[model samples]
Target: MILKYIVERNNKYKTIREVLKNEFKISSRLLTKLRSNKKVLLNGFSTYFDKEINFNDIVEVYLNYEEDNSNIVPNNIPLDIIYEDESFIVINKPAGIAIHPSCLHYDNSLSNGVKYYFDKIGLKKKIRPVNRLDKDTSGLVIFAKNEYIQECLVRQMNSALFYKEYMAIVNGILEQKSGVIDVSIARKENSIIERCVSNDGENAVTLYEVLKSFDNLSLLKCILKTGRTHQIRVHCKFIGHPIIGDTLYGTKSDIISRQALHAYKVKFIHPLYNNTVEFCAPLPDDFRKIIENEI
Candidate 1:
């Protein structure tokens, strides 16, 4: 893929490196590549990183390197593709499926399935997930086609430019119709699998609106201001309304076996397209049935 940049008249950058690093937000490692052997064009001619760029200078960065996918074994696991384009793909991942390969799970992950799909379609780009969901949580997961796009999306994620919305069924009704939960979360001292609200942890924020209420359950629309491990579940527990079926932070449910949390929607500005895009995954059968029969 090629990333094009045009120097504006009022820009303060004096060198190509400054423009690449500050304007285009290219990493130092990639800058080294540009300085050594990678292709960089200035005004339609091959140029060096130290070249002086003037007003209206046109710069193009060519990244055509092949990625190594030897670690991720391709498998024929079925995938539900929600959205796809030249730069990225969004999949409606099902519950109980791990997003990436781990020690316990080798070949049955969503990455394996994506590798298989890419190979079947003769695509050569490596599978790089910009965002991941828990193994037991179902919802839309985004994957970038190449490293540059992945880096761009990661910057956006760090700046909280991405908007992710979730649907969760909690154990009880909330007194307030809508509110924000601002707290810090950290890993437990002796437990690697558990997280708790703590002052020494990273700041986590969640905004929720009660969508529907029942005698013993409430459906909520949750927006994540900051993404943290078990942020939603821990915050719900901190507020005394843990999600249904979340045994780690809340009580188990007879209706479901895993946490009743689903990443239903995501909105972001496409780095390549420069347009706002949104994708939504329809509620899975288990989640829908719970709301239909119980709530």
Candidate 2:
């Protein structure tokens, strides 16, 4: 992706380096790569970085370059892509698919599938997923197409610019229909994959509202203020309302094959255009069935 910058009256008489660093907020690391790759253009031609420019000076930084992604074995696993742009791709991932390739997942991971899609489209950029969801959690996942874009989006995490919303089905009806859970969470002792609520941990906050109740279960609309490993799961468990099928934090159940959680919405500022955008993932089959059949 080529980021264009027009030097306006207030942004005039600054070097390309200053313009990119101060005005465009380009990281030093990304600037170095752009310089090395001769990707920075001034007035439709390559120019010295330190050269001073005035009003209307057009500066463009090209980031849609190719890279070697052979480390991940591309697989043709099906993907539920929601939106795609020159800067990023958003996917509505189903339950049971790992995000990144691992020793056990190998080529069956979502990254592998994304690699295949990128290759098919002739895009050789590295796979850079901006956010993560657990293997058993269905969610909206954003994958940045370039490193610059990745950095821009990643910086928005846990901030007002990025908003993550989820729908969760948990055991027992909540007494408080709407409330916030402010607690700290840390890695469980001697456990690599488990998280627990503790005083000696990172401050995690979750704002939740009870949306629906059926029998012994309640549907909750959860908004994560601080993103941590298994944050919602750990917080729900701390409040004595763990997700219905979250075996790691709660208990296994036949009502749902995986964790009864879904990242239904994601809102963020588009890095390239600075436009606030939001996307929603439709509830998957199992989640919809439970709500429809149970009610």
Model 1, 244-275: lDDT tens digits are 99999988888999999999999889988889
Query: Each candidate's lDDT (Cα)?
Result: 0.89, 0.90
* Pairs in steric clash, model 2: 1-64
Q: Write the per-residue lDDT of candidate 2 for residues 1-295, one digit (tens) a residue.
A: 6788888888644699887887777898888888888899999998778989888889988886778999899999899999998889999999999999988657889999999999999999889999999999998999999998898898898476899999999999899999999999999999999989999999999999999998788899999998999999998999999999999998998889999999999999998888998999999988998888753
Query: What local lDDT score does residue 213 receive in model 2, on the 0 to 100 scale?
Result: 90
Candidate 2 structure lDDT: 0.90
Count backbone overlaps in model 1. 0
| Candidate 2 vs. true structure, TM-score | 0.96
